[model samples]
Target: MGLLPLNYRRPDHVSEEDVRRNESSVEFDEKADASLKSGYSGTSPGIPDALTFDRILNGGACPPCTVRDFMNYLIYIEHAAENLQFYLWYRDYVRRFDAAPASETVLSPDWTRAMEEDTIARVQKDATGKAKKDAPVARELFKGTDFEKAPEARVESRDPFATPPRSSAGDTASLSGSQATSYVSQAEDAFSAVGVKQPFTIQPFRSEINRVIATYIVDDSPRQLNLSSCEQKAVVRALSYTTHPSALRTLSQNIENTLRRQAHPNFIRWSICNGNPARVTFARGLGVGTILVAAVGSIILTLSKAGRGWRALFAILWVLGIATLVAAAKGMCVVLHGLHHRNVRPWELFVEDNTTGLEQLHEGKRSFDSFGSCNSYEDEPWVVKYQRRFYVRKVFDREVWIQEPALRQIQDTIFLQSVLLALFGASALTAIFVAVPAGGFF
Candidate 1:
C-alpha cells in the first residue's frame, strides 16, 4: 500500500505542462519561504544587522514592566531630588545654628572671629544644655540667611532728671518716652515698615517641577514594545557614535535637523528615542535592572554562604562591579556630577507631576480642512460622539469628557506580564540546570 502511494506520488512522464507546473510550484515555495523569513527575522540570513538595544527597554511587550519602570524612575528621581533638598536644608540649618551672630552683636574683628568659631562649634556640638537651647531659635530664624552682618544699632540716651531743661533740648524731649511706650512704638514701626527687613520668603515650591519630572519619566520609559522615534535616535546615536564612524555624519546632521524642528533638548543632544516619556523611561529601566540584578545576585551569593568571609568579600566586589557598570551604562555618575555643578543635591527637592501641554494638545481628534490639514475646531468630532453614545452613553451628555487611564492601564498590564514571563523563564532555566539531570548540581 505504501509502495502504491509512493508510485502514485511519482510523475509518470515529463511534459511541457508538468515542467511548467513544477517550476511554478518551486517559485511559489521560494517566495513563501522568503516572505516568512523576512516577516519574522527582518533580515537576510548570515548578515549582521544593527543591534536592537532599544527594544529591550521596559521588558519588550510587557506592559507591567513599562508601568513598574515608569513609576520606579519617578520615585527614584523624586527621591534623589528630595535627598538633595534635604541636604541643602541640613547644611543651611547647620550654618545658621552654628555661626549665627548674636541677634544684637556688633561686627568688630573680635565679634566676626568669635561668630565664625561659634558656627564651627555649633556644627560640632556636644550634648550640652545651653548650646542646645540656643541652636533651635537661631536655626529657625536665620535659616539660609547670611551669617556675617554689621552690629546692631545702639541708642544712647541721657536721664530725664540729670539733663538740664532748655528750649534747645526740645527735639530730644519729643523723642523720649517711657521704656514700655517706646518699646510699643518700636514694635509698631517694625511691623509697619515697608520691606525694611529682607522678606524671608520660602522659594516658590513649584508644582510644575513634579509634572515635568513625571513627564520626563513617562516619556523616557518604554510605552510600547519598541523604541519611539526619539528613543531610536538616542540609542542609535549612542551605539553608532561609540562604534561606527559611518553613522556619525548622517546622525549628526539628522540630530541637528531634529533639534531645529523639535522643542526638546534631547532631540538636539540625541539623548532620547522619541520625545515621548515611555521610551526614555525604558532606557532608564535597563540601567536600573542591571544594578538591581547585580545587587540581588550578590545578596543571594552572600546569603548562600554561611558566614564565609571570602565568599562575602567576593560577592561584595561582584555587586560593586555591577553597580559601577550600571552607573556607567546610565550615565548616573555624570548626572550626579551635573547636579553637583548646579549646586543641587538630586535627592533634596522633588516635583510632583510631570505632564506638559502636549497631552492636552494631542488628546482628541483635531479639526482640519477637507485636505486633512489640522485646524482649530469648536465642535467635537463625531467619533467622540459615537464613542460617547455607544460606550459612555450615560456620561456623553456631560460637557467635560474626563480622561480614562487607558494608556496607564495598558502600561501596567505590559509591565506585569513582562516581569512574570521573565521570572518564569529564569526559574525554568534555573530549574533545568538545578534539577533536570537530577544529580549533585545543587
Candidate 2:
C-alpha cells in the first residue's frame, strides 16, 4: 500500500487467513534470507544475492529489472504472465479510480463516506517519510483526497511480503451496497477502456469489474488468475458495489506475492546464468586476464635460462588474471570490487532517489522510461534480452559507488571467492610448468 496503496479496511468479506499476510510488517525468518549469505553461486533456487524480492518490488537498484522487464520475462521465459498482467492492470485501474472526478464517484451515500474515509487514510499514510518519498508526487492527480500530512503519519512497509497494519477502530470506510441504491448491471458487457474516465462509478467500471471477473477470476477462463473462490467473490462483490480499487486489493496482493516469491527468483537465476552481467562481464575479464596468462605461459615455455624458482614467480600474474576472470564469471568485477563501486545500467538509472540526478535518466530513442509507450519492450527482446553483450551498452553504464552494507558484503565475498579459485588454478599451472621436469620450448 505504500505505493499509494489500496484502502486497508480489514476485509470482512473474506476469511481472515486470506488477508492475514496483507498486514504492514512481515516477520521474516532470519535463517531463510538468501541475502544474509554472500557466497552466492547464482545456482541456488532461492535468490542468494544481496538483492531481495521485496527490495526489487519497492523499486530497488536491480538493473534491467522493472515492471515491464519482469513482465516480459514472465511472458516469454516463465510462460506464466497472467498473475503479473492482472496485477499491473489492477494497480493501473486503481490509479484511474482514484483520479476519477469526485462528482462521478458519488455512487451512493454509503459509497461517499467509505471513499472519503479511504482517501483521507491513504493520503495520511503517504504524506510523509520514506514511503512519501517514493509515493506518487502528483498529489494533484487524485480527486477526493486532500494530500495532507497526518500529525501522526502512518508508516507502511514497502515490502510486498509484509502486510500493512489494520486501520484504526473508527476507520469504518468499509461499507456494503445496502447503504447504496444497489444499482448493478447484470449483463455481458465490455469494460475495454484504457483512458482516464473508464473506472468512475455505475456506468463506468461495473462492466470493467465484470470483464475482469470474466477474464481473470472465472475458472479456466483465458488469462485466468489462480485465485481462491473467496478472493474472487470478494473482488466481484466489492467492485460490483462500487468501482473502488479496494475491491481488487486482496487479489492483487496475492498475485504480487506470487510474482515476488516464485517468478522473480527464477528471473534472477536466468539473468545470472544467461546474461545480465554474467557473460558480458565474464568475457571482458576473461579477455584481459587471458592475455596476462598467455604472456606468463609464453615466458615460462620460451625462457630456458630462467630457474624454476623465478618460474613460480610468473604464476603470480596468472593468479591475478585468473582471479579477474573468475570474479566476473561470478557477477563481480574484481577491479570494481577493489574500488568498492560498480557500473549502473541504463535502465537502473531512474530507480535511484531524486538526489542521484536522474532528472534526465531517459534520453535515447530506445529509453524504457515511458510506461505504456509503444517502444517499451524494445530495449532488448526477452527471447535474447539477457543474451545481450555489454560492449555497445557499456557507454550507457555509469560508475556508481556500492554504498549499501549488504551489497558491499556480497561484492567482497565474490572477490574473495574469485581470488581463492585463482590461487587453486595458479598452483595447478605452476606444478605442471615449474615443479615438473617439463622442458621449456627453447
Candidate 3:
C-alpha cells in the first residue's frame, strides 16, 4: 500500500563511484557557468567585448560594434548628436540675425524719408510738363545760335518779337507767322535768362532706392536654407542703395517672421524611433502573425460551407495578411507614415537585399575586378555584402532619414495589427460555430 512502486525503492547506501560522478558533474557545471560569465565580461573567441548592449545603450567609449544591434544603436546616436548640433547652430544664427543692429533699418525714418523725397521730386518734374512741351519751340527758334552760351544779362533782350497777350482767339490768331516766331524767340530768351535748362527733367532715384530695399529684405531672412550666393549678392546690393533705416528694420522683422514660420530641421525630433531593433522585430512578428491567421482563415473558408459574405471576408483578410507580410519583410513600417504625416518607405531605414558581386560574376553578369559592379555598392568594408550573397546597402542620409513626428506611429501600427488579428480570430470562431450541428438549446 506504499505510494511508490516496490521496484522503485531508494538505494540502501551511497556508492563511491556514484558520489564521484555527482561531484564531477557539479564541478563541470560550475566551470561552464564561470566560462560563460567570463565570456560576457570580456571578448569572446570571435565576438568583441565592446559589442555589448549595455556599452552601446550607455554611449560608453567602446570598440567598433560588429553586432547589428549595437551598430545600429551607435549609428543612430551619432546621427542624432550631429543633427542636434546643426539644429542648434541654425536656431542660434536665426536669433542673432534677428537681434543684430542692421535689422532695425527696415522700419527706420530714413527709408520713409527717401521714399518721400523720391516721390516729391518725381511729382515736381511731372508738374513741369508744360515747360517741357515748350522746349521744342525754343530749340527750333534758337537752332542757328549757341543759345546755350547766352550771356547772363543780355539773354532776355536777344528776342526782337514779344509774345502778344492772349485776350481773344481772334486777337492771338491775327498775329502773323513772323510775329509768332518772334514770340517764341522771346519766350526762349526768358527761359535761358532764368537758367531753365532745355529738355527739363529730373534723374530717377526710385530704382536705386527700390534695389536697396530688396537687398535688405533678403539679408534679413534666413540665408542657410536655400538662398544662393548670387541671390545674396543681389540682396546686399539692394540694401546698400537703401537710405531708409525704418524700411530695413521692417524688412528684417518680416524676414525673421518668415524664418520662424519655416520648417527648420530638428535633430532630436527627427531621430526618434529610427533604426530601432525592437520596432523591426515587432513589425516582423505582426506581419508573420497576420499571414498565418489569413492562411488559416482562407483554408477554413475554402473547405467550410460558409456563405459568400464569410468567404469574401476571409479572402480579404488573406490579401491584407499577405500585404502586411510583404511590408514587414521589407522593413516598411506603416506606422511611421501615419505618425510623421509623410511617406516613410522601408528601404529608407534598413539595408535590404544585400548581395555580393560574386553571384553576378559567376553568372557572367558582371566582371570580377569591377569596382562599381552594383548601384548600391560602396568602397567601404561595412558596405560589403552580407551572408556572402546579399549586398547590404547603406541607409538614407541622416537628414533625409529622420523627420519631426509624434511617437503615435508606433501605436498606430501595433493597434492596426492587433485589430486585424482579432478579426481573424472572430472569423475562425464564427466559422466553427456555423459548422457545428444545431443541437438542443440546453
Candidate 4:
C-alpha cells in the first residue's frame, strides 16, 4: 500500500473527481517517491544537506526534531532545561514587544560588550569548582544570525525547510492583554523590587522583565540560566534603562547557541539510534541475542568445574556484550560520537501538525496576516506542532553496528587499578566453587 507523501498538503476543496483522477495517474507515485528520497538521503541522493544546522536552530528544523521533541531530552537527559525554556520565552517575549504600539515601547541603548567588562571577567576567572565546569561556553557559532538581533533574516528567508511549516503569528504577549492583569503569584512578586520605581519608559513590560530576571537571569534563581556573573549584572543594569527585547538579548544569543551546539546534536544522534530502522533491528536482535547467549553461556561455565581463567574469560566477554547492547540503545558509536557526525536516515523528517491552522489559514477560518503575511494568533501559529517519524514495517533492517564506549573506558580504568583487588574476588569465588564441588564435569 502506498503512503501519502509526508509533505502532502490536503487541499481545501478536493472534489471526488480529483481523487479518482490522481489515484490512477503515475505522476502521484513519482512525486511521493521523490519527496521520500530527498528526506532520507538528502536532497541529492547520498549527499547530506548542509541546511541541517540552520534548520535545527530555527523552528521546524529536521522533521521530528522540534522544540517539543528536544525539550524532553534536554530536560530529562541533559539536565539543562533552563536554556530551551528561556529561549522559548524570549521568542514569545520579543514577538509581543515587536507588535506593541510605538508610543508604549522604548528602545534601549546598545548593551553590547557587556561581557567584556572587567567585573564580569573577574567573576569568570575566579570561578572555580562546579561553577566553572557548568558555566555556559560563550556564544560564537550562531552569533549575528540568531533571533536576538535579526528575527527576520532566517525566518523570513524563502529557503525550503525539511518540512514546510504551516504559518507564523505575531503572538506577542502585550501588557494590555489579560496576562498583565492576571493575579501575580507569590513567586512572581519576588521578582519585583518593592520600593524601587521601575523605569517609566518600559512601564508596560517591567513586571515581565523582572520575572524573567528572577527566574532565569539571577544568581540562585529557581531555574537559573548559565549566564556569566557580569552577564547577569548587565541584564539587570540594562533593564533599569529600557525594556526592549534587545535589553536582555544576551539571554537570547547565549541560550540559542548553547542549545543548538550541545543539546541539538545529541538529540539528533538519539533519534537516529532510536528511530532508524536498521539501528532498532540491530539493538533488539543482536543486542538482546548477545546478552542471552553470553549470559547463559557464562552462567553454565561459571557453575561447572571450569578453570578460573576460563570463567574470567567468559566474564570479560559478558561485560563487553552488555556494553555493545548499551551503545546500540543510545545510538552512539564511539567513532561517530567522538567525530560528532551522524547519518541522516529515512523516514526521520518531522511531520508538522496540520489539522487546524494550515487548512484554516488557507480556507479563511483563521488569520495569518503577518511575518511573510502569516500567523493569526498573538505568538505563533495555532497549529505548529511537530510529529516524529512514523514507522510502518521493519524486516531485514540493516545493522547499527555499535560498541558502547563510555563504560568500556571506565571498565578498563577500573580494572587496571583494581587488578589486585579483582584477584581477591577471583580467589574468593574460586574457593567457593572448590568448597561446593560441581556435580557436572567440564
Candidate 5:
C-alpha cells in the first residue's frame, strides 16, 4: 500500500499537541475542498475525488502516478489549452496541500527513496539513457537530474509535409550545385506564385541598449568572419525552436541585425546578457589598464631618471587604470549602466566551464553548462509560513532551477568583477614595462 503524506494523516487517540502541531494541515484540507467546490479543479475532465499537492507533485497515492508522468503529459500537449489546466492544478495543489505557508515539508524517506528508485529504474529501462533528461518543461524548478546534458534523442519530426528521402540507386540523383541552385530558383518562383517570399525579417537592435551594442555593432557583417555557415544555422535553429518561439525569433532577428554592424569574438558575451554591443567599449577595461600602468610607471620613474611630464602621464594613467579595475570588479560601469539601465539587471552571470578549474576536470571531464543564484540556494532554503506554521515551498525546495537566465545573470555579475580585477593586474605590469627604464632589470 502507498504511504500517506504527513499532511493527510489525522491525530488519532494521540495527544492534543500532536493535533495542534498539525492544525495547519486541517485548515489546508478544508481550503482545498472549498477551492474544489468554488470552480478549482485538476486539468483533467473527471476531477479526482481527493486531490492534494503531494499528488500533483509526486503523483497520486490512489492512481500511483509520479509527478514525472504528469510532466510528460504536459510535454506531449506542448502548447495545448489542456496543458494550461495542468499548470493551474499544480498551482492550486501547492497552495492547498502545504502544511503551513512557511514550514518546509521535508520529503519523507520513503518518498525520497521511491523517487530515487523510480529515477534509476527509468534510467535503466532506457538503453540510451535518453529519458533521464526528458523532464516536463513546466515546474522545471524541481531538481532530480540535470536534463540539459541528456542524450541527443531528437524529437520525432511532427511536420506532415516533410520532403521525401531520395537515394542515388533510385530514380532520384544527387544534384550538382548549379542544378541545386536551379531547383531553388524554381522553388522560389513557385513560392512567389503562391505569394510567400520567405517568412522572415531582420529585427534591428537599437545600439543604445547595453554594452552588447558596442560589442556587436561596428560597420561590417559577422558572416565575413571565419565562422562556418553550419555555426550560423545552429544558432539560428536554437533561436527559432526555443520554448518561447516568438521571443526567440525576435531575439535572433535582433542578433542578426546587430551582427551586420560589427565583428567581435565577444559578441556572445553581450548576447548572453541580452545586452547591446555599441554601448560597451574597451573603455571600461582601458580605464583600469591606464591606472595600473601609470602607478607602476610612476614608482619606476621615481627610482630612475625619467622626465617630469612623462612621469605625470604615467601616474595619471596608472590611477585611472586602478579605478577602472575597481569599478569592473564591482560591476560599476556608470555611463553604460545609465544608458542601458532598463535592459541590464544587477544579477549574476552563468558561464560554462569546460575544464581546468576543479577536480572534475582533472578526472578527464568538463561541464559545458553552469548555473548561478541570487543568494546561495544551497545555503539558505526558502520556506513559506502559514498562520504561524512552517511549510516548504516546492518551487524552492527542489534542486532544479528553471528560471535559467535570471539566476545566471547573478553569477555572471560575480564573474565579470573577477575578470576586471585580473585585467587591472595585467595593465599594471604592462605600464611598468612602458614607463620604467629597461636598464633597471639589468
Candidate 6:
C-alpha cells in the first residue's frame, strides 16, 4: 500500500484519558495481541522506531496541515540537508589529506599565487643586472642567428604549393633543407587558404625560450637552450600529474548526494500539496461547506416523505462530505493522490547511513518513477496538469505558481464557499417544501 499522510489531529478511538482509565482493566496478553494486529513487533504497533518518530515529530511545525505550509517546510528541510552534507564532505576531505603539503599548496589559491610571485622576482633579479652589462654584445650575436632573418627571404623557393622531392632509401635525413623548406611553404599555403594570413610555425618551447633568455642575460652564454617537441610534451605531462589521486571524484559524489537528498523530499511534497494557496483554501472551504450542506439536507430528507432515490442521493452526499473532510484535513489533493501513489521516504530512512540515504534520495531509486520523469506538464502522466491550468500565472514570460497574493486567494475561496452554501440551502428548501408536499417522486 502507498504511504499516506498521517492525520495527527484525528484521535484514535482510545484516547489518552481512555487508555489511562482502562490500563489496569486490560490484560497483558490482549494488549500484546492488539499490538501484533496493528503491525507492531516490539514497541508501539504501526508506529515507526522511537528515534525515527522523534525525528519526524521534531522535524518542524507538525508537518503542516496546509499546502503552503507543507511546501515551505519541505524546502527548508531539503536546503538544510544539502548544506549539512557539503560541510561533512569538506570536513572529511580536509581530515584525510591534511598531512600532504602538495595537496594543500595546490588546493589553496592564495598559496599558489604567492609561490609564483616569489619565483618571478628571483628570476628577474638574477638576470636583469648582467643583461644590462652585455646588451651590445648580445645584440651583435643575435644578428647572425635565424631569429634576425625574415622567414620568406630565408626560403630557397617562393612557390607556396611546392612539394618535397622523394629521398633515396639510404639517406639518413630523408627530407633535406630544400625539401623541408618546400613542406613549410605547402603548410603556409594551406593555412592561408583557410583565411590564416600568417605562416604556419611550431614553437613548442615557450618555457625553454624564457629559460634560454634568462641564461643568456645572466651567464653571458651564446648557446641557446631548447627542448624538442617530444621532450616538451613529456615535461608538461609530468607537471600536470604532480598531484595524483585527484579529489574530483570525491567532490562529484558529494555534490550528487546533496542534490539527491533535496530532490526526493521536494518531489514528495510537490506530489501531495502542489503549494497552491488558492487551491488549498478552496479545498478547505469546500470540504467544510459539503459537510454543512449534508447535515442540512439530511435533516430535510428525514422530515419529508421523500422517495428511495432522494434518500439514496442524501446518503451519497454524506459519503462525499466525509471524504472531502479527510482530504482537506490532510492537505492532499484526492484526484492527484489517486493518480500518483504517495512514495514519501520512510521516517527511519531520513537519517539512514550516508551511502544508503544518498541512494534512497536518488530519483532513479524512487518507488514512483513518474516523479523523476515528469517535472512539468509537458512531460508524461500529467501529474501537475490541473495545477498548471488553474493556479499558474505568467509574470515576465515565466510561470509563477506558489505564493499567490493573499487577497486574490481569499476572494476565490469566498466565492466557492458562497456557491456551495447557496446550493445547499436551495436543495434543502426544495426537498422539505416542494418534494415532501408533492406526495410522490417529482
Q: Pick the candidate with the highest TM-score.
A: 2
Candidate 4 CA-lDDT value: 0.43
Who is ahead in TM-score, 2 or 4? 2
Clashes of 6: 1
Cα lDDT tens digits for candidate 1, 1-442: 0111111111122233443354344432335434432432222121111111122121342321232222232223212122112222323433443454544112211213243344334423322333456556546666665632311111124345422221221122121112323323322232222112321222121122112112111122111111122222232222211222211222222222221122111111121111113223433554456546645654454445333332333333333334333333322222222222211111111121233233223322111011111122223233243334432232112221112122222222323333444455444433433332222222
TM-score order of candidates, top first: 2, 4, 6, 3, 5, 1
Candidate 2 yields a Cα-based lDDT of 0.48
lDDT of 4 by residue, 396-429 (tens): 2223322323223322332232333334444554
RMSD of each: 31.6, 19.3, 31.6, 21.8, 27.3, 26.3
TM-score of 1: 0.17
Candidate 1 off by > 4 Å: 1-284, 295-304, 307-367, 371-402, 405-409, 429-442
Q: What are the per-residue Cα lDDT tens digits for candidate 2 across 193-303? A: 101122444545665665565555543344555543333333444454555665555456556655654566666544432123533465555647674765666456646
Using Cα atoms with residue i matched to residue i, what is each candidate's TM-score against the true structure?
A: 0.17, 0.45, 0.27, 0.39, 0.23, 0.27
Tens digits of per-residue lDDT, candidate 5, 1-442, equal: 1223222211122232443354334333346546544544222211222332233343443211223323222222211112223233324434443443223222111123243344334423442233334434412543354533442332322344322222111111111122222323432332232222432222121111111111111111211111122222222222222212221222232222222112111111222222222122343556656665566666666566555345545544554465454444433333333232312211111112333124323221111111111111222111111122222221112122213232233334433453455456646654555554534431
Model 6, range 76-112, lDDT digits (tens) per residue?
A: 3332222222333333544554555653445422223
lDDT of 6: 0.34
Which candidate leads the pack in lDDT?
Answer: 2
The sequence of per-residue lDDT tens digits that candidate 3 reaches over residues 1-442 is 1122212211122233433454355432335435433433222121122323234333442222212222232123322121122223333434544564654433322445445345435434533453466557656777777774453233234333322112221121121122223323422332232233321112123333332222111222111112222222222332333333332332333232222111111111222233334444565666677667766765565566555355446545554555455444434444543433322222222233244234433322211111112222234232332223221221222223222112233324433554465466556645654455433322
